[model samples]
Target: MSTPPPRRASAAVASPTAPLIGLGAGAPVLAFDVGGTDIKGALFGEDGHIRCLARIPTPVAGDRTGQAVIAEIVNLAGRFAEVQPSVNPRALGLVVPGHIDTRSGTAVFAENMGWKDVAFRERVSALTGLPVHFGHDVRAAGGAEFRLGAATGLRDVVVVVIGTGIAGALFVDGRPYDGDGLAGEIGHAKVASGPTCACGGTGCLEAVASAAAIARRYSALTGAQVAGAKEVLDRSQAGDPDAKLVWKDAVDALALSFSHVVALLAPEAIVVGGGLAEAGPALLSPLTARLDEYLTFQRRPRILAARLGENAGLLGAAIGARELMVAGGTR
Candidate 1:
């Protein structure tokens, strides 16, 4: 696949007003952000505003095969097209959680969704009859952060999302470093010695610091069902010892992982997103303090919260689709 031209500098930097939206003029594009639990989609108009935003549960449970997932996305696109007859989507951008080989437009692996080596771009394009651009979900979100949200104006940065799982997307010298679908698996990096991961690995960072892991660990310790990580944080604030311990562990794990990133990549900032980041000061304050302790001489990067919220991935897909149009030798 041909590489798209570099995004315009304005497109790569966040604007003061509505930073999450891209800044280019192009034909309207349809975008899908496929996660483990849900699929969020939107149609981005030439004026850089999203329309017909929708969210639906992922078909992972109902459809064991990857084909059904693709079918559902095509169905959603059809619905969007039907709703907006006046606006035609010139291309489509699809992003999914997994090890994605973007060069081949293949979703190489996604343990949560149970699919591997699926040709997502080809399938979606053939079904929708529009040019398609495919990307990894976390990286796509990071792209949005880099170009239109938290990490804008930074050349070297790490955009980390701590949701049901943890992941990072690296941007060095104003370009995303995908590393053939394996660059930012920070969630899988070992941070402890015991907790087993869904990937059949022990002590992975995701097993400790992910929002899902925090709730799971807290529930196991108290033998009580909690709503989610937010609840756990609230419990900690209320002086629950178990919640405090679990939260501390998660913060420690994140600090350790970030220290490694700082040593290696020396990023200017680490822009954090996802459910856990909703803790706001509760997460950032301690994380910053702990991270400070870990860094001795390394250039400590600023830790900041993601500004785009949940729609970052969708906006990123739109950005990729617009770039794809340019790459296809069109507008």
Candidate 2:
């Protein structure tokens, strides 16, 4: 093992104006959020501010995808070091999509990225010569929301990211409930029948409720080849019949899935985010109404939109890095 850098206590303290408390408030840190197409990297300084940030295209290396990503991370780290030579990072936080096993520090599977059982934490630590914290991207974003976004102070909440695919971060009793890193696969939960999903499942929640699903279904129904879900939403508001039908189905599927979650977990809040969440009230109002239809005896959760925007996952990764030095994170 390589020699570890000199340790320093974390100095991050959550402030009212900012969602993050003490980020790289000590020995500095590197954080990365790896998406299927892009990788976002940031460096945090002793004062907990982002000292450097960059986004790079994710390499398409087939079976070598994992190695390629690790190389990119190393390159980003070196770039940050060049930009801030005075800082010596003590830890690195990394997050990626799909099923994750944080306990094992592995990417269990990511269909889009074409990788499985990739031990990211061990590899990154070995290459970077620093302690590495690994996590799921959606869950990391949810952590940011829980500590610094919409669900702050909520003990029981579900932070659902509704972009290309639907996934969730489960918080129970004010602590993240990872279920061994697979508990938040709410997207795969069966909702309807017919129409196969990318995971080879039929009637999965993500197949019907996700932003990608909305656009795909609308394009199929109307044969109009819309640009994205936002366009479909706009058409629906403009009284387009096909767009309305697709949008309603998407909302209904979401409500059905959310109602099941409410019945099982009874979360105090359901914080929605990601590309679809940009619809704001247009999405939440109808979903809430449909959810109410299914919840006759269960407690209705307050459905709120995420406030942290696109940077939540990166911020959460930074939090994971800072947690290595801080006694209690989000303080």
Candidate 3:
């Protein structure tokens, strides 16, 4: 799993203005998660809960592209302020995926969104007149895992996401390690040995094991289009030959990638999330069996489902924003 290391340490004490702290006691942060298809915005209250959450389809093309995303977030900020006009939010917390340089607040690149080197933090901060705390979506999720979720209390764990694409967040010593700005890129790691990837590589894990890859490979083999990885899972359960082969291939490739991670990081647990992880036993039981069959010397880590469901990224974004606000002396 390619996981982003944490950019900072978890808070020593939760503050009144901290993102997930006060819940029913105080105001909430305006949180936004930018994605390829939609932008999800919500008010994450101090009590560690979400309110007024909504989604808007992302606009495509020209200057409206990036600004459109920012605009939705700013509008959400306005709504948050209007609802609790007495105490306004002083900052925004945002989570985005793909090659983000969190330190620079720049999206270095996002192949799915066709974005590059966009100073997203500055844009949002300028538009809202509030400081922005930005985080890589997967990395932020890892932070949440380390501080509060499945990977909590574990010294070393890998959080692997099998979604439209595959990626991961790593936690070591209860903190994320970025390796500069290029640490986690597990999805792009070579795994298939021959298939070409959209990132211009051959045999990338994303090419072989991601949700898109499962559907694409099934289509290529059977000349029939499947809805997504879930449909492929259904067909596999029904004993369809092509579906079985496709699903098996995905598991095998993912196991190969995880093996590499195990060899390198020695994480105590591997937490799996995303659309494919919803498969539960269909993915996990066999994956564990196969990995055990493949390795000899390495200590096998527990392969478990993600506890946070689809909201992990959003929750993580909230945490990242809170940490930033605290660090900046806003709380």
Candidate that scores best on TM-score: 1
Clashing residue pairs, candidate 2?
12-22, 13-22, 14-21
Candidate 3 lowest-lDDT run of ten: 6-15
Better by lDDT, candidate 3 or 2: 2
Tell me the tens digit of each residue's lDDT in model 3 across 1-331.
Answer: 3433212212122112323322233335777778777776666666557655666665564433565566667776776666656545556788888887777888887777656788889888888877788888877776776667777689889999888988888888767887765776798988777689988999998998899999999999999988999999999999999999989988998888888889888889999988889999999988998888877899899998887766677777777667666687321
* Candidate 1 per-residue lDDT over residues 1-331, each given as its tens digit: 3433312111111112443455467889999998877777787778877756777766644224467678778877877777776779999889999788887888888878777888889889889998899998999899999998998899999999999999999999889998877898999989888599988899999999999999999999999899999999999999999999999999999999999999999999999999899999999999999999999989989999998998889988888898878788321
Off by over 4 Å in 3: 1-27, 62-64, 84-87, 329-331
Runs in model 1 with CA error above 4 Å?
1-23, 61-64, 329-331
Local error of candidate 2 at 201, Å? Answer: 2.2
1-331, model 2: which lDDT tens digit per residue? 3433322222222212444444434658889999987888888887777777777777777767888888888888887888778978878999999888877899988889878899999999999988888988999999999988899989999999999999999999999988887788888988988478988899999999899999999988878998899999999999999999989999999999999999999999999999999999999999999999999988889999998888889889988888876644211
Candidate 1 local distance difference test against the native: 0.86
Clashes of 1: 0
Sort the candidates on TM-score, descending order. 1, 2, 3
lDDT of model number 3: 0.76
TM per candidate comes to 0.91, 0.90, 0.88
Q: How many residue pairs clash per model?
A: 0, 3, 12
